[model samples]
Target: MKLISWNVNGLRAVLKKDFMTIFNELDADWFCLQETKMQAGQVELDLPGYHQYFNYAERKGYSGTAIFTKHEPLNVTYGMGVPEHDTEGRIITLEYPNFYLMTVYTPNSGGELKRLDYRQQWDKDFLAYTNQLAAKKPLVYCGDLNVAHQEIDLKNDKTNHHNAGFTDEERADFTKQLDSGFIDTFRNLYPDTVTYSWWSYRFHARANNAGWRIDYFVSSRDFKPYIQDAKILTDIMGSDHCPVELVTKDLI
Candidate 1:
């Protein structure tokens, strides 16, 4: 199975910038997106041979996520079942016979760490939700988790240490979650490799390759053996972020 995850930043904006063109090229079994920033009917998508599922934030033009899959899932869920956290429409889960596939746009802590407390709560809740699901089935979750997770996951780590996504609290939350038996697909595939998915629009970050690997394809530990490859599609251009991909040999 081939899965591709991208933080499109803005679906409508990327649509004008050849989003469909790249989408067609991927031809993945499952394609996921984060930071979609739109509600239903805001944009029209014609993805042939794919089932489209979208979760929109209550506050329009903000956080959202989507998934386009070739196969229909047994069940689909929109949130983590936490009322306080469900308003942003940041999560979407599709339950297949063998595993649960989820895409999440984790809350950003904001420029001055204003939302850090709430973000921390979210991190805790999200991990619990995933663990609950894992108790029933293997999981394949992907999206812009919004944290660098480690110093090696970003460029200029020293300078970005205090930044929103690189804050100590956020990083610790990620570490704790991973310790609970999930694998960062890319890192597990290439332990020391350095690559990034999200880049700042400032300081010519993309041009200089000053970026952060905030997006991820993470799975339950038991599911890792099936993953054949993990990739960061840095060359594709449209949004400030690029697509990350995972290829798994058939295990079903």
Candidate 2:
């Protein structure tokens, strides 16, 4: 099965930018989206083949997530058991017979490290949530995780060391999570691929090939054997972020 994740930045804006066409081109079995930034009835999608599940932030036009799947899941869950985290609509899990598909829009630490503390807390909670789910079955955790993870994951590690996504603390948290039993699927498949997903809109970052590998499709260690391939659709347009995809040989 092919599972794709993309941080659309803003669903309404990207829709106007022809996200539907890109979605069609992907033709994935399951698609997860982050930073939807809209509420129910606020936007309409004409995707006929997919079953859409949305988790909107309580605050209008803020952080949010959604999942569009061609195959209906056995069950779907929203949030990470913390009311504080739930309010942001950052996580959504779809449970299939074989594995759990979790999409997360991890909180950004913000400029000047304003929300660093909160972001650390979010990392802790998110890891715990994934661990609990892994106890039941294998997992596919994919989305804009908001961390560069390693120096090679970003274009300019030296300059971005203190940045929100590249901070030592943030990278360490990501490392710890991976050490806990998840594999960064793309990096594992294309170990030498320096491709990235999200890029700054400023200074012609995308045009200059300046970007960060913040988005990911991380699989539980148990799912490693089934991972066929992992890809980043950098050529696709519509959002500042591109789509990250994972293809598994078998669902189980």
Which one wins on lDDT?
1
Q: Give the local distance difference test score of model 1.
A: 0.92
lDDT of 2 at 251: 78
Q: After superposition, how far is residue 65 of candidate 2 from its true place, in Å?
A: 0.4
lDDT of each: 0.92, 0.92
Q: What is the lDDT of residue 131 in candidate 1?
A: 98
Off by over 4 Å in 2: none
RMSD of 2: 1.0
Across 4-65, the per-residue lDDT of candidate 1 in tens digits comes to 99999899999999998899888899999999999899888888899999999999899899
TM-score, structure 1 vs. true: 0.98
In model 1, what lDDT does residue 105 have? 92
